[model samples]
Target: MAELIGPRLYSCCNCRNHVSFHDDIISKAFQGKNGRAFLFSHAMNVVTGPKEDRTLLTGLHTVADVYCGDCREVLGWKYERAYEPSQKYKEGKFILEKSKIVKENW
Candidate 1:
């Protein structure tokens, strides 16, 4: 019998809690506060903080900080609203800092 495999995942670097799947990534070319980031269509095992408007490299956007549910570590942010039409695609998506996450089940 063939051995089964699990989905590749991204985990919180601080706690190793599963946060996202590799297949859910939308873009890898993103910038975060520390360094590189990734855009993901969905994230799990996370908590969103209060929403606030912030000016980013893209533009002004309503975003909420996302934390690791297990450890409460600040992982990144979720795009609640985008002011610019071109940036609207990011709405409801998640940005996870590369420095804050680790690969799992690879």
Candidate 2:
């Protein structure tokens, strides 16, 4: 099995917009309606979203599409609101595509 790890830095491949996240914050790999894949993160930075685009996603409330601050590339999204009590934990978190982000060391 893969051993549990700690925090690591990641960045946008197109513009180098970066964010740091603990391995624990990563939720799961999700496939969007547009057929795009994303890696969910409970914490992120150097992003600009959760303000411009909004839409209803699954059981969640209005989710915002996030972008890279430097290149305006659609990096991921933030779960702005949650409609269900169980989903409330996902609010304020981010969802970035693994393809869009590259590990600083790897």
Candidate 3:
């Protein structure tokens, strides 16, 4: 069985609430060789769905999928550039701010 790596809060597809959460962890190097410059190889499944989707076509546009634990809301997402150079990935360029949180009154 795969180990839980990354308690990422995500919203349940069946329900709009964001209680359903999963951990995403990638220890391998997912750059250059991996499809699309670099990607989170090991835990790619966690962020990406099995089947590709329309518009995105691939449905693997997710760099990071942050869901809410309380309301199961799709809090935020981080997209990645496939097969690009590693330098393209700016350090500390990605972040999840406190403002992204949607506090419900209920």
Candidate 4:
């Protein structure tokens, strides 16, 4: 029989709390406040802080900080709104910094 396999996931580096599934990743090429980041279509076990307007490399956007639900460690940010029409596809997506997350079940 084939062995059962679990979903590949990314966990918080500080607390090992599952944050996102590998399948949910939309893009691996992104920049975070600390370093490299990944764009995910969905994130789990995380908390989003207050929304704020910030000017990024692409343009102005409304975003909220994302933290680990278990440890409260800052992971990245979620795109709340994109002012530029070209960047609208990122709305509602989550960004998780590579430095803040570790791979699991890979």
lDDT of each: 0.98, 0.64, 0.31, 0.97
TM-score of predicted model 3? 0.25
- Tell me the tens digit of each residue's lDDT in model 4 across 59-94: 999999999999999999999999999999999999
Ranking by TM-score: 1, 4, 2, 3
Q: What is the TM-score of each candidate against the true structure?
A: 0.97, 0.67, 0.25, 0.96
Model 1 CA deviation exceeding 4 Å by range = none
- Per-residue lDDT tens digits for candidate 2, residues 1-106, read 9876544767787866565454634555565545444545554555555454344455646677777777777766777777788877777777776677777644
Kindly provide the TM-score of model 1 when superposed on the true structure, using C-alpha atoms: 0.97
Over all chains combined, what TM-score does candidate 2 have? 0.67
How many Å off is the CA of 74 in candidate 1?
A: 0.4
Q: Which ten residues in a row have the lowest lDDT in candidate 4?
A: 2-11
Ranking by lDDT: 1, 4, 2, 3
Model 1 residue pairs with clashes: none
Model 2: CA > 4 A from native:
1-7, 22-24, 33-45, 50-57
